[model samples]
Target: MNKSAYIKLVNGSAQTEITLAEVKKLFEHYQHMTSLTGQQLGWDYKAAAFPYTMEEKEQGGIPYLLLNGNQTQLYHYLIVGVSQEEETGLHYIQIVLPEQATHGDLAKANEFCKYLAKRLKGELHLFNGRIIYYNPRK
Candidate 1:
């Protein structure tokens, strides 16, 4: 069984800010795409309660969420984070699975990652370090 999976999107040479507006749209689109309601998901932060809706939270920061369990069950959430290359400081958006994630969970995460990678016009890198999606020059 695979322990985890990842979808990483690189932002090229420039480091661009991931705006709240973009995240909000992504969340909305995700909800629409998956037909997932508030009860089905939650932010990773403890102060944030379950049955939480994205509309209820203020936008403007990188946010992570759990699919069906609380924080202690790390394997159930969607992680959104930024990684910077040491030499150039170029940023990449990463969506990764928790340590105990199952194949079904990974499938869900990958679906969302595919949508985000297309929307962001970034590369989709799998946990195995393969570039799965990228725009080719015309």
Candidate 2:
């Protein structure tokens, strides 16, 4: 199941805000903690992999992550920005899996989403609108 997942940081009353610093910190942590290498399949293509290092880039002042590949072309990325919703205006971060993403990519995305939500005091919103990483005890 190749799908996207969002990590949204909400303030009191679900107001959206830009949390660039925190998001950057989270990205840095992800980079430090993960080390995955793609498998060699053939001369032209490689197996979809995970834990890829993402580079920070900005377009129109919005920050996003680009999966870094040494020899292969990659399209997977993570975007960090504010949500467009008027009522919930919240800081939104998302992991966009490439269309060719494999099961490993999906698992990694889910794992990272959970980690990010816990660390940033955020919540994971799946593409289907299902929420995760919420601690009912808290």
How close is every model to the real structure, measured as TM-score? 0.56, 0.61
Local lDDT at 84 for model 1: 53
lDDT of 2 by residue, 1-138 (tens): 446788776653132454556566766665544422222333222223333555677788676666543324333343334344557665567777666765555565676677777776667797667997543334
lDDT of 1 by residue, 1-138 (tens): 333343333444122456435555676666564444434554332223221243322237544443453433333554555555577654466655666665555665666666766676666676656666554434
Tell me how many clashing residue pairs each candidate has: 0, 2
Per-model root-mean-square deviation over C-alphas: 8.2, 6.9
Q: Which stretches of candidate 1 lie over 4 Å from their true place?
A: 1-15, 19-21, 33-63, 67-75
In order, the Cα lDDT scores of the candidates are 0.51, 0.57
